[model samples]
Target chain A: MTERADCRASTVSYAAGMLREQLLSPTPVDLRAFLMRALRPRDCLVQVGGLAEVSYHGRAASTAEVGSYLVMIKRDGSLQIHTPKGVKPMNWQPKTDEITAVLEEEQCVLLASRRSPVELVRVTFLEVQMAQALELNEEAGFLLTGSEAQMQETLAAHPELIEPGLRVLNRELLVESGGIDLYAQDAQGRFVVVELKRGRATQDAVSQLGRYVASVQRVVGTGVVRGILAAPSITGPARKELEGRGLEFVEVNALPLVEKRTSQPSLF
Target chain B: MTERADCRASTVSYAAGMLREQLLSPTPVDLRAFLMRALRPRDCLVQVGGLAEVSYHGRAASTAEVGSYLVMIKRDGSLQIHTPKGVKPMNWQPKTDEITAVLEEEQCVLLASRRSPVELVRVTFLEVQMAQALELNEEAGFLLTGSEAQMQETLAAHPELIEPGLRVLNRELLVESGGIDLYAQDAQGRFVVVELKRGRATQDAVSQLGRYVASVQRVVGTGVVRGILAAPSITGPARKELEGRGLEFVEVNALPLVEKRTSQPSLF
Candidate 1:
């Protein structure tokens, strides 16, 4: 199902379970009010793209050269302004910064400021190609886990779950390129390099394992060295690459049930 | 200093310490090779926007409707496809997934796949508005410290750092609306609500602290309750908001030097 709305200054469309409002013209618009209305439920993403000129005044005054810019505002009021290309934004208002939006007839401006050290970013939109607000479901309690370490610890305690006679040699073995998750040996006495992922394994993991396997094989000789990718699941492309490279994949769950059980004293 | 290069199919320009490569034509171009070359050092961001139609065929076969799409590729091979207004990507390849780019006469395609689950995402560029690659500096050894928690611990250990006679009553005090980082009593015996940030405090933090202060004030009576925002630094906007609302700002460093000193064994 799809729903769409159009105002004098913008077009709002909903399709494929997403609500999007796009402003195409250079008309004067109340950006803050528009954002408040569009970002209903307070957890959407606001993206502004166009030519921008930024100036900072107070501690010291400086003007940034005009350029095409992309500004992303998170639901938490944190926002960043990025130039055409780069990993980091040229200027940013971290999540803790206060943001105020000012809309005028000629242009729209966003002010992000903090007082003690006196930092402020004044973003002036010269021409706004697009100002869009996308509705997103609030993700609940997305906890960050120390998964790789947890997986290694789990496997070390329960090596048999991986395969019979598989023995863990060491954890986090540093190689020239990167660190190997686990160094191990199988029942056949052949050296094995194990790569663990806390979640579903992807093609990059396969490639990484492949590189480590190649490096280890060079030192251990091709016939005696083997590689294994350990994760809860593997993607199709990753599995294809694994089998094609003569490597193996094992599903390893990283629940700390053993640790929990060991930490609790038995009532008996 | 700035530099620029242009080919029949694309134009590359550098200005304001940023390198920008853009392809404006409707004609087919080898986007993969262009990306591989432009993203030299392999740690840049690739953003493709305009119109996109994606098809997935492998374990499950489905085709996405043609629409304006934004595709972001990170340095670590993670990519996400977003419609103009969604917080989550319509399709995504996690960082662990392997990505391959293929350029054809009619279209430029990117394939992200995983082997075990037999998953694949084939993104076909129907119309390219803008394709850009920007250079970024390599960040070295970025450490993640639990700064907020550390700050709370530090202040609890050394309340004198914040102000004389400031006694921490409790940590993570739950209020009606939000949790106050620290609940304390000032030297004047006023109920002080503290909000702590490990890094620079922004305007949002001030707003949040205001909310907490208001909630606590209702119970303690307005004149008796006070708000204090503590962080490593404060931005101008945040400070302005702090002053406007009659709140206090305090700088707190979270190096854990005190904890380190106490944890060490005596050399004597």
Candidate 2:
């Protein structure tokens, strides 16, 4: 009996260990106190699974039916409501919006309001299941420096990299649908709609190029309007789509143009 | 000339005001030094527009084509790559991974590595057009407490709230596709599949309910399986879909089930 009890105790601790590092309560009595302690000035994601009624008053008034909710609060005071699927949030308020949480006798309510747009969102929790606070570390990932304009400039300076006979005509040429990255002429004098990507080109990029080609063809009439997708690389799916669409793909390497300043004295 | 200069000056400051409140640099000389200064322990979002190549060596070896990239660094050391559109990132590294940034004479490189599965990601920036960092403030949003399990349990205990003669037969009944939240028999003795949403029901939720009903009907063979979507409220589009599909919608209010203990002594 003692051995069985010891085994059970160890299992409980093991389970606790998995969650205890990030969570404070196995079960909390005061929901407000828990939130006050858990919520920090950084990013926090809260998942609620119970009855929740969300009411929003904005351009047009609407209220969400009571259901489970996932709430994400960015460090900049912006908040968004998410369902299980889809990239866009079911509902959201901008970073400038203000939010406050109030704990009543047996319910916890959160109120978010925006001034300029005059929007209000009120979320009421009928039952408390789990509440966890996580501190978001922003600098722990990659920071990139560069822009598409720089890439475009670099590519334009070296049109030979695209094809031997390709001659550049205009950059950011205005069309009906959108701006074409580059307008060029091929060796055969066929108008080429060049779509430049700073990274691996995806299927969407190919489709975008197709749209540009179609738009240009509509305006250019009889002259064969060819489409060319230029990037460092292209994905397999994107390549397949490009082939199917009879579009040409060219690999353009973005080499550093400026000479390294090795002669400079090390400040660090 | 003075008026022209004043207009130009105001325009410059106006553009500066638009970016300066969140970003420190009008233009930075050294990308690494700027990142070292801009990257804090909190959440920061960095967008770069130039030639960038991302290489990943992990369970599967792959590389991203050189292109403009949006790198988001969470406070937890996790990072994600975002393209111009799409809800999900092109690639991502989890918090458990380690990241390092190296500044070369003419290039800025970011390396992220993980051990357990053995993964490595290298992002090389050929040119930096724009790099801006914004500090995240987490406490500005709402914090919620609740769980779906509790809502399910409550509704199961009070089946009468759903309908007059509705009786809950089983909770989480396993079907071919997935588990039904609640299976019940209505007043007409017809089998009913109850899909409970703790918040506002969207079109996706209704579709999910429809799937459950279809799966139940396929299994029950002849007994008239009906789907009932129960939530605090339903969206206009969701209601329209529900009506078109001939499904019933019920609003279930999430009221506090327990009374408040006001007599207790306050402890802060």
Query: Cα lDDT of all candidates, in order?
Result: 0.65, 0.60
Cα lDDT tens digits, model 2, A52-121, are 6676665434566665454545445566654332334456776435666776556677677888767777
TM-score of each model, paired residue for residue: 0.34, 0.38
lDDT of 1: 0.65
Q: What is the lDDT for A216 in model 2?
A: 93
Span of 10 residues, lowest total lDDT, candidate 1 chain A? A1-10
lDDT of 1 by residue, A86-112 (tens): 345556655424666667546677776
lDDT of 1 by residue, B1-268 (tens): 0111122254545442223454433343556666556545455566666566776533334466666666777666666666533235556665424566666556777676766655677787766655666443323222223457766887888888888999999899997655788999989999899999877887667767877887788788747788999887999866976897899998877554423346665221
Best by DockQ: 2
Write down the RMSD of all candidates, one decimal each. 21.9, 18.2
Instruction: Show model 1 residue runs off by greater than 4 Å.
Output: A1-70, A73-109, A112-268, B1-12, B15-19, B30-33, B55-63, B94-98, B113-120, B136-151, B154-268
For candidate 1, the per-residue lDDT at A149 reads: 78
lDDT value, candidate 2, whole model: 0.60
